[model samples]
Target: MLTIDSLSHRLSSYLEPTQINRVKRAYYYAEQAHAGQYRRSGEAYITHPLAVANILASIHMDHQSLMAAMLHDVIEDTGIGKAAISHQFGEQVANIVDGVSKLAKIEYETQAEKQAKNFQKMAMAMARDLRVIVVKLSDRLHNMRTLGALPAEKKRRIAKETLEIYAPIAHRLGMNDWRIEFEDRGFAAMHPLRATRLHASLQQVRGNRKTLVEKIQAAIELRLQRESIDGLVIGREKHLFSIYNKMRSKHKSFKEIMDVYAFRIIVEDIDTCYRALGAIHNLYKPKPGEFKDYIAISKENGYQSLHTVIIGTQGVPIEVQIRTKEMDELASRGVAAHWLYKSSGDDDSASAGSYDRANRWIKRLLEIQQHTNSSVEFVENVKIDLFRDEVYVFTPKGEIIELPAGSTPVDFAYAVHTQVGNTCVACRINDRPAPLSQQLESGQKIKIISSEKSQPNPNWLNFVITAKARAAIRHYLKNQRHTESVELGKRMFMRALTNNNLQFDQLNHDQITGLLEKTTSESLDEMYESVGLGRITALTITSILLPDSDENRDGTGITPISIESPDSLLISFARCCRPIPGDPVVAHLSTGKGVVVHREPCKNVSDLRSKKESLSDISWSPNVTGEFLTIIRVEVKSERGIIASLATRIANTGTSIEGIQVDERDAENSVITLTVAVTSRVHLANVMRSIRNMRSVTSVGRPKT
Candidate 1:
């Protein structure tokens, strides 16, 4: 039914000679490069590229993008490379091709990991060069359109990926038209039954509303003609998946979801958009609070449009979007819209700067990759940042900062400045004091109260949003851990002298260094860190340090045994369960790993009892005077500031914490379990009673077992 000549004629007004020549050249080159390749559908593989290029051209892309679109698969499927493409076309086209080609190289161990990492790369690349994603999206669009020949399993995989990754990316880029298509197609492939039902419902609605749409279009066109405003009006039906999402998310029936039918009014200029909006409002009653003027405050992705929802004929709610012809092109094609405007000889140097801010987040990915070594963590961080919902907030000066949805004030503080986040002590939302973990909503003005004395609280790690905030908090905690371990190692070394009946000055540094080297530890300092982290123990080092112990233990009634006794053995504490300050505990001697202490009733420790060979009796020292780790149970009511206030209150008692576990979700009560390090039973009792007296706190006691 459609011919090339007929399609060309339809596009004659916009397709200039230069564009046509490039398209022809690209066609010839792609055809040769993909000569031997055939698609699963039995069509020449070159046809796929051509189809994608045709999609781009339909959106009025310029010559360079068209060339890149045609040659996108040449490098991947064919043996063509970036260098060859650069030699044939210019570096610009080659760059686009290379970006897409790099994305095709990602191989992951899992499907989720693969999809997440692929999207991450694509996102970063698109942020750098928007054209890269436009080309890839167009390519995917064509592939999705022609996926009939693929197996059902493959179809579902690609479709689900498109729904999760591509559609969201399209939405972020503000490609509304393309977004709807991608979502609908993906939804159809993923949920065929739902898609079929939705399609049937839409068909029914279309049949019933045919007369209404015609009457509305005629009325609008006649009015525009009378006003001498030249423009195009196209009716847009709501996509099935979108309707499904709305129904699922909002719990609405199909009939309850208004604005299912909309009209796009494309004109020549911005002034005409407003004029058309006025005209449309005059024709129908406008819905209250349903108007958005994105033209004035364009989104981060360069989307600009005037939107309104109106009660159309028969009290049917209809959405209307007005934009210029250029805006429409950008709205549909997004970054690829650059290609269309570039052919007009417009100076793009100034306009290019508009996209720089959007690309900054992408640049951060490269920065993150440099710091991180593990692929799984990298993929995880990228996914957390990308797929997370967003909340738009304003700074003191009215500058907008978009953060992940459910982001606390801490994330906002970090978004402003890393220093501010690190030192953030308090916050104010809309001129009132708020907690750091308060969920930020759209349009709220926020202010962070910071202090030089303020350090990152471990509790803050539980509630902060945004990957950057989480990563920063984690990094800080790791650094803090290193610092604390170093300090603790020094103290433990000093304290051991009394137990060993040795003077610190009498120990040989060279001998100690040699002992550390045999264990493959870096230095005395590193050995100390290992000891503090419970990797090695005091007895293990004492044996290595005092190996010439014949003089020291000759008449003390003590004999060195090849295997340590199950009783009277020093054990290294497990931080996993952190049998802290005053908890009943026992030890398990792991082969070649020394003794590992655990809570007496801990499942991990209990499981080890079956292996009697590895079992060891561990008891608290009779002279134990310093702090020990204990997990205490504290019950409290869940409310804002409870965690922060509790943490502050606990810290005020000069007690260090091993960890805090909160599960305050039973019957309107919050149960908080805290693992604290305290000097004695007296100190722990005081701390427990103090916590019990605090507001919202009901009961505080040690674990009964």
Candidate 2:
């Protein structure tokens, strides 16, 4: 029964006569294009597009969006080209239409990949023009509304995707109304029996709920009247999906979930909003710790409201939300509210903030896309960023930072900027030193400690929840490996050149080019990377460059490279030997890992010695700085607080305990294994001597590999 006539009449509310006429023309064009096409329900396909346009009209979307909604399927279903739409409408409308068109299926991809690719392409479109996604969302909503005509398997698939992706997208955009609809409808289609039971239960309680809500709504109304506050009072309507989600998440029964009566108080201005809140609080005593002032600090989606709970008649809890009319609409329509106020000349700073917030989110998605390894990963990261319960923390300067619940300092650092996250080595919460992995809470102030030598640890991926942090860390590590590989390869090649009585700086361009060609490397850096990764040997490059220099490969020819910093990406100290500064160490060429340092006397080094190509002499510089992990065993009597004593002693020696484990030796004694941080052998010796002198300590020695 829906038609373009009703939509056109509604459009006349704000749109000019010319815009309405253009929309009508687009509708008629789409209708003619789909003359005989029918949906699975046997209804004319034109009805679907008309219904989609109606939904956009409800949001008061731009006239162009409405036109695109009408002709969105024309390009994909009717085989009409974008050129045709462009010739009819303007380029903007045509582009929106093309963007909303379903992509032709790409061959040779699995179903998951196909879905990821589709979402990736759609996200790019969303970044181009926000209207494209708004139109596509409206189209999806219409399809979801009439989903009963779909087959069971197909219906479930569509419902699942809606709940997983579309619903979250709506929530992220602050489209509360559309999000609730999407979730409820998708829930019904996915789980028919559960939805039916929940619906029936709600119907049974509707009478009592309405009565209670009305009684409390009247009390708030009378209080506001007495206070001379002009406000609109309305009882809150509970959505089925929200109710079900509450029951599942809170593990409560239907009665418990429905116990609290809810209402909304919409005032004329911000001052009146606060006045109305005071009036309501005077009528009913407010519950402590149940108030949130979101108006002062808007949510990430720019939702603003003052929420509080009060004890009402018969001691029953009443939940209320107070806001201005604009806030109320912005809460529901979200970014789309920008257009709702556009033609009315009501585009204020608040609406602009909401629109800009949504744009920032979309921009972040594009940034994550650049660093992601695959479309699947990008979509997964987007999904991670979509659903978040925010915690508001503060910076040292009193600026508020909002992050997802359970976010750590690393997540916060990346939220600030990529460079901050990459270089941050420590954190202070509330002016006290705290572990970087400690979960942050609301209202706490954070300070990040950064060092130029610090790099993002691969282990950060284990705890970082934000997409930006994960992507940036991965991107940095990927680039860092290449740089480290090049550096190591350069040193190895220089050593080989030195042994052959050749200076690398003196090599002619022709000679370097010939060597690169022989090594199948297109550039000098490529040859370095190949050698660094162990894909090709440094000796091979030297042999090819100087064919008569085979005799230069002697043990004495290899020079020792000073490893000032073992923390470099390519130079890692082997855990087996736990090499610290002042230890005689050798660089073991490890494929894919570059150089790994092992103590000379380590048993593992003896095995690697047979492969002379893998061996390169190395040593620590006197100025070597940074903590190194080493294991030490302490034989101690089982005295009370013996482990505590050892920890205190280690700290007194300026050595930090990374780990502590107890090994029960007998009834009266225990072997304490301590993994401590040390600068060099002298530092370790000082720590050992400090521990050995303790009364509980019988002996102290480093564990040899």
Candidate 3:
């Protein structure tokens, strides 16, 4: 049904004669490479690539992109190599083909992993040349079109990936045509029954509404004509996937959604576009607060238009959009639009601006990639940002920043810069003090209050919505843990050395190198990190350095490490027993969690003590200066102001109530669970005594498991 000659004829309208010839040459080369190969549908394999090239041509892609589309599958399907493609076509075309080819040389444990790795490879290639994604998108479009020959399960997998990734990517790049096509086909393949039912419903509704829709279109056309505003008026068709989504997401009947008539008015230029909008509003009163001027503040994807809702004739609602011809074209082709690839003048500034915005999005993906170590983690982080509903907020300086809805100041901080996010301690929204976790709304000005001594809180990950912010927070915490672990391991080894009377300064470079090799560690720092993370013990390494057979011995008479700094990243107090200052505690070496301190009598520590290598003796330092969290349970007689009175009493103890909950309640007695911060065990006892003095409080004591 398709051929190279047919595509060449179509390309002749815009592409040069030489460029068309080059595309033809690439086609013939691909044909020879796969001479005897046939596709699953029993057609010549060459047809697929040719179809892909045609798709690219429809967007008027440059010659190199078309050529790359033609030879995209040659390296994967045939014995041909990338070097041959490079030699035949130019290096740029070959690189694109390689980028688009399926990289399935190695075995993978699961489908998701394989997909993530392949996507990661493609993302790298995409960063190198933006055209690679354009060609790859075309290749995927052709595959999706021909997926009927595949098994049902395979079809669903491909369809899901297309909807989850490719379609959203197309939308983000401003390629509305490809994105809609992808969504419609992917939806159908993924849910054939639902799609079939929705399509039939749409067909029935279209027939019933055809007359009314035409009448509305005609009315708008007449108004524009009378106003001397030249424009093209046409009713817009709702894609099947969009209609289905609206039905499900909005929980509306098909008829309710169909009731809204949609139309587009394409004008000759920007000024006329606004004039046409005003004329339409005068014809039918526009619904208040329903107008959006995307023309002035374009979307992050570079889409520009004026959208409005008005009460049409017969009390029906009409949704209308007005835009210039160029803007409409860009909406379809997005970054692949021919104008973006060419040189720009004052008239082409919109195209150039749109292209730059697309580049910024791609580079953001690169930043996320750099912070991720696992391909799976990277894909998971990336998926979080794919479906952003934008909320435009401004900086104090009046520059607009586009962010996803429900994004917090932490998300905004990371968006500004990674360092700003890492150092941000507080925020001022609209010049008034606000919590950092407050969700930002449109038009609000944000000012981040940062401190030089601040570091990212791991808790930020629970609230920050953007992929960039989450990744940066994770990156900082992970690196911080490693640095702290190494320092703790070195300190532990120093204590071991003091006990053995072996000085760390006395060890030579060769001795340290030998010790690292003995542990199969790459460097001395890595061995220390291993020790700190509990992978190996400090005493073991100290014995290796001294070889003093008695030094490796475990148990009694060793000086316990003083936990003077309770807030050390390497030392974490266990929650189960909640051991505070002056409590007798023992430390357990948890792999990857440097040290976990538990009360000496804790049930968990009973079994852990048998493993001598894992258990260590630890003591609290005098004058430790941090608040420790402890839970206080109180049984109170049924009365008013019980919770408020307890909160006040807790606050009167020179501290504040951290949290409060009612665990169990009856008509006579109510159990109140209060989480309070105290300086020490003595301070906690005094708070409990103060609460016990209240008459409503029947009993007050600490709860232990």
Candidate 4:
């Protein structure tokens, strides 16, 4: 039912005459483009754009934004092209329109992929120009308003999308009014019975509490007046969706949910907001530990307020929010408040600052997209970042850093800078040394310690919470694995050549080039890197690179040995026995996993030996060399020098003790477990024998595998 006249009238209030004419021109052009098209509701398609434009006008968006909203669907639904829009309106308008357009022409594997792709596109577009999202939000708002025309299945799908994505986006942007409306509408479409019951309950509650709410409002107003603080007191109704969420999350019934009747007090300034809080507290007792001051530390979405729970008449618990006029405007309208201030010729700096703060997360999404190539992964990460509650911590310099709740020091390091995260070695929380995975709390000061030689630990990914940290860590680990794999591949190839008595100097450029081409690698280095990364087995590459005569020599030339590499990254030793080089070994070809080598006598190996199809014969190569892990149990007299003597004897036998733990201690004797690094099983036995020769040592033996 919306018309061009209503949109024009709305625009006339803030837009200049020329700008209004431009918007009008876009309207007429869109009408012509959709002359024969009708919506599912049997209205002219042009009405949809007009309604969308009206929504933007209500938010006082700029002329360019309004034009984009009007012409948003033209590129996707009509014959009009982006070039034509650019020629007619300008690049900015054309870009915004293009940004909001969906990729309907392209085919996707599934509905989820298509949706993820669209959201990814929208996220990228919003990063470039935030106006695109504002316009898209307006477009979706009109669509949702008229969603009844669609089939039930489609309605549920769109409503679910709105609830999960659009509503959260609105909340992130500080558009509380739009966010609440979206949630309510989506809830009605997705769960009609629940929505109806909740609505009825809310209405009944309102009817029963009308008098009590009025009394509380009057009391708050009178207290503010008595304190000489000018304020506007209003009853704030709880949204049904929010109530439903609380019920579901807290497992509470409708009647059990308190704070159903909330109130807000909008004052003249920040100081007056605090004074109003004090006045209200004087009039009504505030509940213990229920006050929050957001004025000093605003939310990630730029919302600021003073929140407190108070016991009002009849001992009813009521939630109260106090904020200044500007803060209230922001709490209601969010980023839309920027347009309102701009159109009124208010301070540009304050508006820009607010917009920048809200835009930071959107910009971060774009950065994450650059590192993430999977549509599903990008969508999941975006959801994680959007839905979690945030915690505020501080840097060593006292600057506040906001992160998701349950974030760790590693997440903090990445939030500061990518390089800092890559090089982070350790961190201190609250001036005390803390683990990198320590869950950060609000108000704690964090100082990251970095070393140039340090690289990201793959284990960090297990606990990191933020998208940036997760994506950055994964990207770095992937690259690091490639680098190590390439080096290992090169070394394996050399060992193959040595076993065949064929030196690298014997191979000509043509042979190397042929080898690279056969492996589908760009260069020799890439082939080696691939081998090291386990993409292609070194044995396979060695067979291809060596002559048939060399290949026929004993299987010893290519036998898998000492899964360990120079960097200790290409292979991992099974923790069951911590196998050394001299132990007989077998490799298990796990699906989607490279070969895992285990000692032949290991209990785990014994259990898996039944699956002969998955087991491959492996042994230690003559050239194999690296430190191996082993545990030793030692029982000694409970004397001070006994511990030092055991360590000295072990060191004398060329073994290094990595760690030691006392199993038991008494007045005469003690038991200790030592994790030692040795070159081979023989080396470990020698060290154990050396320790056993000591007078204080009652027993020395390898720990049970």
Best by TM-score: 3
Task: lDDT for model 4, please.
Answer: 0.82
Please write out the lDDT profile of model 1 over residues 448-518, one tens digit for every residue: 98899677877887898676776676666666666655554455555444446776678888976777787
Error of 3 at 229 (Å): 1.6
lDDT of 2 by residue, 579-661 (tens): 88988888787888777888889989888766564677777877888889989989989988888778888899989899999
- Residue 57 of candidate 3: its Cα lDDT? 84
- Each model's RMSD to truth, in Å? 8.3, 3.0, 2.7, 5.7
Would you estimate the TM-scores of all the predictions? 0.72, 0.91, 0.93, 0.85
Q: Which candidate would rank higher by lDDT, 3 or 4? A: 3
What is the TM-score (0 to 1) of candidate 4?
A: 0.85
lDDT of 2: 0.86
> 1 or 4: which has the higher lDDT?
4
**Candidate 3 lDDT score at position 372:** 84
Of the candidates numbered 1 and 3, which has the greater TM-score value?
3
User: Candidates' lDDT values, in order?
Assistant: 0.72, 0.86, 0.85, 0.82
Query: Which ranges in model 2 have alpha carbons more than 4 Å from their true place?
Result: 102-110, 396-398, 425-435, 444-459, 502-520, 543-560, 607-613
Native-to-model Cα distance after best TM-score fit, residue 670 in candidate 4, in Å: 20
On residues 1-705, what C-alpha lDDT tens digit does candidate 4 reach at each position?
577887787788888989999999999999999899999989999998888899888888889998998898899988799999999999999999999885223222347787788888888888888888888888878878988899998888888888888898998898889999999999999999999988988898788878888988888888888999998999988888989999999999888784456999988888888888889889989999888888888888898899999987778888999998788878888888898888788865445656887789888998898878787788788888888888899999999999999999999999999999999999999999999988998889999999997888888889999999988988887777666666656776777677666788989898888888889999888887766555666556656776465452333435443554423445667777777778887765453334567777787876775543345456676777768787888988888777788888888988889999986576888898999998887888888888888988898886665
lDDT of prediction 1: 0.72
